[model samples]
Structures are given as C-alpha cells and as structure tokens.
Target: MKDSEADSRSHKPCVPFGRIAVLGAGSWGTALASILARNGHDVRLWARRPALAEAINKTGMNGDYLADVPLPESLTATASIAEALADVDAVLMVTPSSTLRAMCEAIKPHLPDAAPIALACKGVERGTGYLLSEVVTDALPGHPVGCVSGPTFAREAALDHPTAATVAFPFSYEDRLNPEKSPAARLAMSLSGGGFRPYVSDDLVGVEVGGAVKNVIAIACGMMSGAGFAENTRAALITRGIDEMKLLAQALGGKRETVTGLSGAGDLTLTCSSTTSRNMSLGFQLGQGTARAACFEGRPVVVEGEVNSVSVTELAARVGVSMPICETVNAVLHDGADLRAAFTALWARPIEAEPYALELSLAHPSPNLPLQFGDT
Candidate 1:
C-alpha cells in the first residue's frame, strides 16, 4: 500500500488514555471507536441493546450500521452506561443533537473527574437552536467541553480514506494543553490516521457553528444538484451558505478564522458536492421533485440538515442576518414553499454590494479574541 494508504490503516500516537467512552452505537460512533482502538487506546462503546453489545464483543464487529467494515479486535462494548463511564479519562459524546441533553442527564451521576468531553454530533436544538457544545456545557456544568467535526463520512473513515477534521474546545486557563508539550494535545495531535488528519483549535464556538450549519447548506446543494442545476447556481448557493454560517458563528461568539478553516469551508465543500452525504442525497431527491415522505422511504439515517433547516432560519431571523439560501430551504421543507418557487424567490431578492465581514461581528455580541487559531 502507498504511504497515505498505510497512514490510513493506523496512524501514529501522541499517547493513549486509560479508558474512553463512546455513548452512541451508530455508524459514526462505531467508526470513532475503531479509530481509537487502532491507535492503541482502550475504547468502550455503549449501546442500549445487550444483543448489539454482545455481537460486537463476541464477533469483534458491529453487526449493523457499520457492518461495512470489521471493528477493531481490541474494541469493547457495554449495555450499562455507568460501566462505560467508570474509570474513563475522556468522554466522546456521539448522540444526536436533539437527544444530547437527555443522554447527558442520564449519565450525569457517572461523569468522571473533569475528563474532557468531546462532541462528535452536529445540529441545532429544535426548540432553541442551541449548538451541541452549548447544550453540553449547559447540561454538565464545570466540565471540559469540546467538539470535533468536518467533512468526515463514517464509511470513508472506516476505509481510511484521506479526510481532515477540526478539534475545538475552550483552552483551560489553568491546565491548558500546550500543543507543543501537553500529552493530551500531543495525543490529539497524532490522532489523525492515513487519509485522516485532525487540526486542533481553541475556538469551540466557531467549530460548533460550522459543523451544525453545514448540514443545512448541504440540503440546499442537494436540491440544486438533484434539479440538474448548473455549477454556477451551486456556486452561488455555497457562497451564500458561507455567509449565513459566518453570520451565525459570529452571533454565537465564535472567531472568524474557525469558520474559514478545515471544519468550515473545507467541510462545506465536501458535503455540498458529494452525492454520498445523506443530507445532500435527501436534498437531491427533494430537488428532483420527489415528495418528502416518498424520497425518505426506508432511509432512517439522520441527515441532520433536514431538521436544522428551520432552526437555522429562525436563528437568522433572530440575529437579523439575511440568509436567502437557508430561508429558501426552510420555506420548501416547512412552509410548503414550492421547490422551484422557493429557488426563484431567492433570486428575486435585491442584490447589493457584498457586506463586509465585519458586519457579521457587528450583528452579535462581540467575542473575546481567540487564543489558539489566532497565532497558529
């Protein structure tokens, strides 16, 4: 195999934690567990079903969702949520954005000693449109919260396909991990394998915003592609997508750089263009004029963007940001706006000189200067 391919097989190591818990048993959750085990760490995958846990432990594989690839032999599974959390040094929460609060509440008594909690899920809360990081922080007071996201697809990660991601968390003012010296930072530094690369940032808010909003934009791209629209139109949608994402990220006190990095622009590019993405696939079907219920037939996989569309629209209105693309998506999906009519409505809006990036900062509460991404 080539060097990149070899790297994909099992990357290097900064160091390994004693134990880590992955709360969800879905495809993405399973893939992350496999990655950790491949890098020589102890990983505990918690599922709600005893049968599923037994299948993984006995067969050394996930029988569903992630059946496309065999799970690492070293990976373990458990049905008890506490059993998974006990003795763990870190927690990787991979549950759906909507279910995050309840899951954390259930595991509240079991939370270990300030272990870093990494969020791998993306989406705005339905009623409040809160980002995953915000929800985690609010639910688990004083805990070290972080998030990881980008153009990652679970099947590709399993296959060791070349991919890049971003890891963002508030830098501890006291126990800050020196990207140069701290073992945890170094371990995270070496976490990327093969075609997988992970970039570390201190901009938790920015990373969260990028991950959450990209799904919404992917739906728009899917619709355009499904409708056989030209590249020029898709380009317009993507540009507007970035603008809307930037507007919200700024509103939520995120750094501008975070939205421009791997997790932001990079992720947007991949999810919007790929037919493989569930969000894009759903949009494509919608654009092709398929009824929502008919196109979603038997596909239970979470597209994330479908649900985020309305939340994003509401957020834009609250912040007073103009997001034509997001508005169009919300109209089509929720307000029963005709697909073609919605698209046309966006074009019908007035055009003006592009707003300066600073306008976004003016739209929300000014945020503190970011420490990590600023100089790096």
Candidate 2:
C-alpha cells in the first residue's frame, strides 16, 4: 500500500460512541479527552474553573494544563457538570485519589444508565486503604467499571506517544479467556483503539496493586537519585521494589508475573526516572535538603506518594508484610528519620527469600486486597 493509503487506513475512525464526558480538567484528563476526540468520538470536558473552560472554548487551547498544544475544535469545555454528562457514552473519572469518592458521589446522579466508567487516576485511599476502584464501586453500584493504567506519563500519552495500558475486571471463569466464547472479553477487546491499546486481564488485583504500590516505589527511587546514587543502586531499588509489589499483589490473589509486566516494572521505571513525575520530583528536592514549601515550588497540587506511603505502610503491617523500603520512605518523609540511616537500614536487614515474613499473612482472606475492579 502507498504511504498515504496506510496513513488513511490507520486514521480510519473506530465505531463511534455518541458522546464521552471527562470529569477532570487536569493535564491527564485533558490529554485523554483530546485522544478520544482524535479517535472521532464527541467529547466534553468539565472543569471546575470557569476561566479554564472559557480559555479552552474561546482560544481552542489549554495552555496551562496541556501547554503549547492546540485542542480539537470539536472538543467542548463546560463549567457545568450536567452539560458535560448529557448523553455521554462513557464517563472518564480523573480526579485525585484523595477526592475520588466525593467526586463520584457528586457525578453519580447525572450518570447515564449502563455507561462505562473509566478510571484514569492511581492511588490507594488514605484512611480506608481501598484502591481507587473500590471507591468507584461503592459510589456507583452496577456500573460497568473499567480502568486505564500503565506506564503512561500524561505529557507523553497526550502527545500521542506510543503507550499501552490494560483494561481489566474480575475473572469469574477460565472460559472467558477464549475471545470467541466470552462477550465480556469481546467487549473489552472492542474498546481498545486510537493511541491507547488495552490488554485484557483477569488479575484486577495485580493491576491495581501494581499501579498503587509503584508510585510509592517511585518515590524511593527518586530519593536514591537525588542523593547522587549511581545507576546500579537505582536498579537495585527498583528490583527490590518489585519484590515487595509481588508479595502484596499475590497476597490479594494477583498473579506473580503481573508485577513483572508493563503496569508494574514498566511504570516503576518511568515514574522513578522522569522529572515529570510528581512523586519523584518531590523526592529529589527532599534529598537535596530543600524545605517542603520550596520543594513544592508553590504548586497547589498534591504529590500522592508522599501521603500514600504512610497509609500503605500501615496496611502492610496488618498483613505482616515487611516493607522495609516503603517503611523507610515513610520515616524520612514524616518521621524525620535520617535519609542515610533509612537507606542503610534496608541494606543491613537480614537476608531471606522474596516475600519473606509476608507470605504467611496471605494464608487467610484479607480485606486489604481489592476484590474486583469494573469490566473493561
């Protein structure tokens, strides 16, 4: 085929959904809304700030969030929640982890029946220790929920950089793995398109655990990087981080290999290394001995890993998981533990096999594991 023909074929529209609503106007949310628009879906974005909505509607740009990129002319920005939710095919929830539950409750009354809800945020709820999806399920019962998670950084995913994420739910039976036999599986496959390729997996526990815990690990890697550690040290932190991730995921019924896949290791590598990652960047400053205020650089946004570390460590204790690395991170960030001391403590710990001292807890049914996320 000619190059032009190939280009045309690639851009050919997927089956259209009538309207799609994105609930947040942050960088990731705007980027995803743009992707849906580029894929030939009508999209509406709801921003809490009227000024942002007006700028996007009038200038055809969202310079603050998605800097220097022109938005699709067809994309609508609305300040009112009702206007955005009207006749939407799917609702993309991109709010912060801390506020996700309240955000869902606010939007629940306006959601269309049977509309698929996709989560674009990652983190464990602080007080409840519930994964983000658990909050969604509690708020919107019977909704076909789906999650989009991977190593995607917003700037890259927004720029149409090649990225892949998984769309998963609870696997009830083995027969569903056969694409020909399972409608849910088929439906999951049907939704993969544009720049976001979706892998279907039955291991929702693995997916969520990998997504949540990786952020905490990214912070640890950042601390090492900030302290002028060499690449070899960085790699060790990442490998050990995966060890903890596997233990936590397996405790919650996740497959061990899932932690080795893109959502786990791939995400850990990207977030830990990139200055764009809020968690890593924050850690870099802390390593440099900068005050917390200056480290924030006056941004009002929250770095999830900073607060999430405390909660995750607390929950890990309940399961008898010895997360020394995560506990060390918690100590430095909150307890004023010496950074060198924390790092040294991890190195000095007695050696054992992977998941040592933690495997025994998974022997019983533990509620810390998220039972199921929505279907793709």
Candidate 3:
C-alpha cells in the first residue's frame, strides 16, 4: 500500500490510550513522544535533568536535541519517574543501551504491571552482551516487552515525514489465541500514526539484533567513505555486512529473512549512506585521521556504533559467527589498529565464493570445483 494511504488508514480517529510514559528525552525519545501526542495520546516524556524538563514543558520544544521541531501540547515533560509512570498504560524505553538496566530498575517500582514496555533504543548491553529486548525482559519480568526499529532519523520522524518500522513482540500462547488483544497489536496500534507506519512481527530477537548490528556496519561504511573509497566499496561493505548480520542473527536463533527486512537491510542502507547517523559520522572522523578521543571529546550524543563494536564483536565470538567487518571496526575503534592498515588487511584476505555458492559446493563436491581457502 502507498505510505500516504497507510498513514490515513492507520490513523482513523481511534481513541488514544490513557497515558504513555516515554523515558528518555533524547532526540529519538522526544520524536517518538511527539508522534504519540500527535496521535492524541497523553504522553509524558521524562528527561534526566529537571531544567531540561522545565524548558520542554514551558516552550513545547526540545531545544537541546530537536531544536527545529515543536512538540505537541499534549506531550509534557517531567524529571520525576514517579510522576511519569503514575497512571501510565504503556512505557517506551528510549535510554542508551549501556544504562537500560539501571533505567529499568529505577522504573520497576513505579511501573504498572499491566503496562507493556516497548524499547526504542538500539544496541546490546555493554558488559552482558544482552540484546535490548533481553535486557528489558530480564529487568522487568512479567511485563510484555517488544521493540520498534527501522531506517529512521529522529529529525525526519519528528517532522512527520513518511516513516515505517518493524514493531516486534514475541507472543505467548495466550497472546497468540487473542491476537487483537495482544500487547504486540496494541503497541503497534498505539505507535502508528502521523505518517508513521509500524508493521507487526513476532521476531523479537531478529529486530533487536538487526537494530544493534546495523550500527556497527554503518561505521564500517563510513570508514570506507572517509578513506576515499568509492560507491563500489560502500556497496560491497553493505552486501557483505548483510551476510554478517544474517550469520549472527541465525546463530542467536533469529530468522535470516529478518536480517533482510526493514530493521536490517532497510536500516543498514539508510545509516551507512547518511552522515546524519551518529555511528557513520563517528567512523568518518576516524577515517579522516581524527583520534577517537577527539571525535567524542565534546559530543553530547552517544555514538552507538563505537560502543556496540566491542559488545558485538564479543557476541560474535561467543556465538562462533564470522563477522570480519564488525571485528575490524572493533579493532580500529577500541584496539587502536591503524585504519589504513586494517582496510589493507581486509582487502588482502583470500578471495572466497559467496556464502550460498560455498554452501552449494560443500553439498556437492567435484574435481573441477575451484579450490576454497579451507580445501585440503
């Protein structure tokens, strides 16, 4: 269906929920809160600083993060978690991955048991290597948990540009029986409106993995761009990056097709090709000979790829997945490997057939077959 038609159909004047607490007043969080408010929901946005909350409440704008877009009057800001969660029907956790656990712990006491939690953040937990969905489930057990992700930039989304995303929530037996009444369906409905379309799925792991791994891949693409590589090189990285994403997703028990879906291929293309992405921009700086410290010295926003590179590489090793691109990014960013040298090494690696072709060859060996790297 056309996006405009979908937007009109999905937002046919349904009664909005009672209240939604959007924890985290960053660009992404504020944008999402604005969408909910625009959809006629009462959205309470939580900011870390009381001053920022006061400013947003007074001016109806998140000047620090989203200076250009004016937030809806229905969307209010607060610094107190208790006030935000007081009578909330749902919660959207949009904080950084590294601090998600602490945020969940802080909200547990105030959160309603019946309220579902939807994660808008990307990336796995830093030390535990847990996907954001897993982290939420672990910290806030008994609450229905899901995630919303796709190729979306906060500014565009806040401005009401056409946007679509995957809203994934693993259904329980009961949820499957009453699909319409399920948390997944409700969350999808609540989040869809104002030129924003959300497609539903049951692949929670696939969604989270795609969202996390794509950031790492975007950094690699940015590095190639910074190093003066052409479109051909960037194309190659994106193609191979999908393979890496699929391998890791499957190793972690997610569907391979999910890696090729909106949260994966769609997101990868947008982030890797755009400097608006924090991860890609950070990689570009590194590629231009800027020190990691210098790149991040005065930056207010967190560059998720720099942080996820370490956890993603570790997770790949633990799952025995071969993600050379992600590993190289981790090496360059965290281990201080020389950027040009790393790219040189990557290019110097032995040539191999595409993954599917190699699989086919493995299933049917022949004397005339080209020798592969591991062939005896």
Query: TM-score, each model?
Result: 0.86, 0.85, 0.90
Candidate 3: give the clashing pairs: none
Residue lDDT tens for model 2, 1-376: 8888887873322344557898899888898888777676788999989999999999988878888777778889998998999888777888888888889888888888877777878777877777777878888987766566778887777777787777666644663544333323433344345566657666777887788888888888888777777588778888988988888888766888998888788888888888799988888777666767888776765888887888778767867777788898999889989776677666666545554655432223332332121121
- 259-302: candidate 3 lDDT, tens digit per residue: 89999999999999988998889888877777777875556668
* Model 1: how far residue 323 lies from native, Å: 1.8
Q: Return the number of clashes found in candidate 3.
A: 0
Residue 270's lDDT within candidate 3 is: 97
Model 2 regions lying over 4 Å from their true place: 1-17, 171-194, 354-376
Q: Against the true structure, what is every candidate's RMSD?
A: 9.3, 9.0, 5.9
Model 3 weakest lDDT span, ten residues long? 367-376
Cα lDDT tens digits for candidate 1, 1-376 = 7988887885334454557888898888888888878777788999989999999999887878777688888999999998999988888899887789999899999988677788899877877767777788888987778877888889888777777788777776543634443333543654556666787788888888888788888998888788777688778877878877888888878887788888888889888888788888899998887888778785666778878888777877877877778888888888999877677556655434476733432222222322121113
Go through the candidates in order and give the clash count of each.
Answer: 4, 1, 0
Sorted on lDDT, best first, the list reads 3, 1, 2
